[model samples]
Target: MTETATAPAGGLPEAVFDPERLAAVAASGLLDTPAEGTFDDLAELALAITGAQKAFFTVADGRRSFWKAAIGLDAGAVRENDIRDSPCHILIGTGLPLIAEDAVNDPRIRDLAAVGALGIGAWAGYPVVSPEGHVLGGFCVVDQDARPFTPGQTRALQTLARSVSSEIALRQALRQARAAGDASAALARTLQDSLLPPRLAEAPGMDAAAAHLAADATGEAGSNVVGDFYDLFHTRGKNWAAVMGDVCGKGVDAAKVTALARYTVRAEAGQHTHPSVVLHRLHQALAAQRVSDRYLTAALASFRPAADGVGVVGRYASAGHPPALIRRADGSVEELDAPGTLLHPDLPPAQDALKDTTFRLFPGDALLLYTDGITEARDRERGPLFGDARLARTLAATRGWDAARTVDHLRRAVREHSGGHAVDDTALMLLRVAGGPA
Candidate 1:
């Protein structure tokens, strides 16, 4: 199909040509880029489910629609064309999906020259948005015959579109963060915060809370950006996940691995019910790309509210990380005994060492996941490290406490133990089952 006029069409919104939105499109790095497997997979899935004749994952600049991935289109077909010639521009203008079940007679674009040239009987496009909420382009499907899409198909297409948005946003965020390496503590804090969940996902029948105490809590200049990250999120169905990890080094290198570990676990946790499998998948991802020589230790748990409503039941795995702790409602603490090797691409045999065990959190009981920073804190005189024994004793003293209070209590204890000078960053997540005894 030949290119069309560059001006906005009659029904298209003028915002499609906004300068900032166009800038976001440029920053997306999707325009004119080589095809990517992720985008290709999205296009393939879109076509598979919709039974569409063709699919396109595209990015649009002011004048041209650049195809990032296309399926069912011949190699000689135009890969880039005037933005006005494609319905994706309508999605950009409206910031919404453009679905034309009968594109040949669809008033919005039937008059366009390319519609007849491409023989589009039906068309559906979902906006691929930027992190800042700008419409960068779209994931669209085209059919040779007019077809009505079911609600289920529409929802699936929307989900796939969101995955595309997430992939782009993550790449953009990490690029910006790595580019800011060793720049400023304020920037370091911002970059570190980006690696963590903005807030913990609400857990059914449980109280969830988390905190990160930076090694440089004093707000001093030139503090190393250590890799201590934690996340609490809901996986598929009734399943929920909690993870805590510490990368081997500091600064942008650590941040890169931290981002990778967090994203990989998130992408895999929904597919697997076992933490060990999720963690092993993470290992494979890390091994596939040696971003750095740095290795990391992680604790991952997948749990769900019990059918009896008495507590939570799930399995947790440890990879050369400290054990997770359970503080019973009666004020006694029990240590978990799952240990495995640290995560490094080169440590294939260590995968066998990874172990996961079933556990339950009864009402009034709390589950604690933490990095070693808390246990390794020393006093101002650099005396004995705070150690696991003290942590257990302290946790046992916080009986009947909610997750929030438990986490706060531990943070204060660590701060005082270290005389307000932590040698490393500390991260903690606690989930307390409801209806605990007073």
Candidate 2:
């Protein structure tokens, strides 16, 4: 392979070869990832806008040219080649578009192999620049016929190139945002996992599954997920306890509150037999800690096995949290409406120290307990909340599914309604009797 003879047109300064442009191209993280339709689509539009036969969008890093998109050429056909042998070098070296009206006659790039070997008669291309004014490559259209490009056609090509530049710039911003978000999500996930039970202990009478959603999800990847936690632990005489809650705030403070609530529940549920007593104990613990400007909202359910029967009875209670929803085997849905006070002193005292709502879960029945973040999540920024009705409808549809499937279906529904990310922390706990009616 012979490198073609080349020279810097228009007395280009040596500063143009500073190598920073190559680093900028790499920093955008757009090279060699995948051929996105975004760039290809833009090239197609450029082809139509310029009335040319073919179009290409590329990224050049001073050393070589790599095609990001190609309309008529095979994929990876122009992946790498010397800068001088390629027409794109004209744009990179001159910092201006190369509008070769007639490549066979135009001295600018006539001797280049792009014209001599490929028979490309005309080229109307502009630079695809980065946000920092680095020339990445060319968004160009080519023709097999020798023809002159009108000034209007040339201007339109420049405008389309600007649009391509804007798109490339957007990708760079998204890459940076995801990087920062990933860092935050990693730490938050570690903290969140540490605060939660490693796994929900298998109960004697039911199948259990749980999923948590943090408000930190900004892109396809998530970050800085909020403080929502749950636990299913066996406690006291052939029974199990289910705990789900949200801390008053987010990050480390909210994580601390989550840990305090879970441990307090675990410590107290063993000594006690009633739901209200456990909640009352939790309220006392939070109050005594004096976690300034912080409190927790929670729900606890204790399941008691029926003597030689096909079902279990559950006693449920909550402190300033959303009521639980249950889907019966017969496809009936009901809410365990327990009015419990938020831990703050300004709210009504925990009535009867947070009353319990006892519900029966027979074979093929499911009990779902979740934090308000699920229902309170909005369709868009400041949009209406997903609300209780939607959740009930979602549960009604997942009547006979097992715990894992039920939680998955409900999570998908919430994500669809909230445009794929919760604005607050979301925690879902689904517990179902394992088999069909015994």
Candidate 3:
């Protein structure tokens, strides 16, 4: 006979203090750990997108809620608090998103001492769950002024919460790999895949395609774990954003920087339309991390379908990255030049160097964003480099192809040029206006 699952006598699941749930949290390795840029970036993004006065990424057990990252709260003074006092308790109780327009007046939590002690006017949050489906804590925000949050803001907060969940899972995997002698390479591959989106988001009136070729093109697992990434996603309304970046190194450290940069751009893209502004925000995040050896080159594009429905208007920005290539409908390829320095703490201020260059993609036109791998590939070891000239010519030759075909054709060309061997990770993203080839 099957037994029916029942809630605790107190009408809750006992999830907050459940031993299995607590074990999962412990495995995350986030409890009492120092703040990290990945978590800080998420919390900061939550504040920026929601206009919240305070935000926190927390891990909670029965006894207390530990702040992994916080913004606007004095870190030294507000490291943690009793679990009963945190607004996140509501999330743990219901296993659903919680929003209280006025925590001080809400009957459910008004009596809680934290309501008066912390002076929380409003609260909004989503659960941060483990890979095993246990809710460990939450990504939450507090407002000093009691104001209702719009649906868009709440959704944005949810997106950031999911990012928190992913980061926790990555850390757990890394720890497990370290403990298991022969699993390091497998962990590296898993972490590398997590850095990229599983698939590109579809856009109206446009075709988007992307490809990634690992340094080990022979399909040797764990042999290469580099930091080349590309992303395409909707911002708000009809606007969409795309970014391609090459972080400086390999393995876990490179993966950390890659994750930081990717999410930082996503967070900034929703609030800004100018590519330079978005990238500069990412630069600030990297600088805040204060890792001298970690830096990157990136290209960003913000665009929306033109009112005529036959083309797109967009702004492009570059940070120590190669110029993006645009292929006209007439099969002519030209470099869309927008230059800047590397994204590093030692680099000059982004506002002074990074600038947006506006351009339009007419019908049948295609734009390509890529890493240096394609241009740097050589015919053989210590042989002539493929360089920009050949890349431009190859792009020009693909006049009328759709985004997918163009990406495939280019990948083939690079492979042939390098004689079937890859020296570095390669990432290519192509955006084409919906019309057929030129």
Residue 260 lDDT in candidate 3: 66
Candidate 3 per-residue C-alpha lDDT over 1-438 given as tens digits, one digit per residue, 9 for 90 to 100: 111112123433467778978998888888888989988988999899989888899899888889898888776776888887776676676566777777777765666666677678988888787655568998989898788988778767866776687577567657666666535556666676766777888877788899998776334423456578898988777999999999887677777777767767765786689999888877776675553357899999999988787699999999989899999888999899797877886777787798999989988988999999899987647577778999999998888988999999999999988887777888999999888554
Report clash pairs, candidate 3: 400-437, 400-438
> Which 10 residues in a row give candidate 2 its minimum summed lDDT?
1-10
Q: In model 1, where do residues sit more than 4 Å from their true spots?
A: 1-184, 217-223
Name the top lDDT candidate.
1
- lDDT (C-alpha, whole model) for all candidates: 0.80, 0.72, 0.79
The residue-by-residue lDDT of candidate 2 on 1-438, one tens digit each, is 101213355543343366878777887677776678877887787777678887878777665667777787766464555556678877776565677767888787787766865568987777666554567888888898888777666656655566566555445544554556746556556566656655678898689999887675565325435467788877666878898887776555555566556656764675566778888867765664443447678889998787768689878988878889988886678888786876753444464758888888888888999998888888667687788998898898886788898899988888988787556778899999877642
lDDT of 1 at 243: 92
Candidate 3 off by > 4 Å: 1-119, 124-138, 141-166, 172-186, 217-224
| Model 1: lowest-lDDT 10 consecutive positions | 1-10
Error of 1 at 174 (Å): 6.9
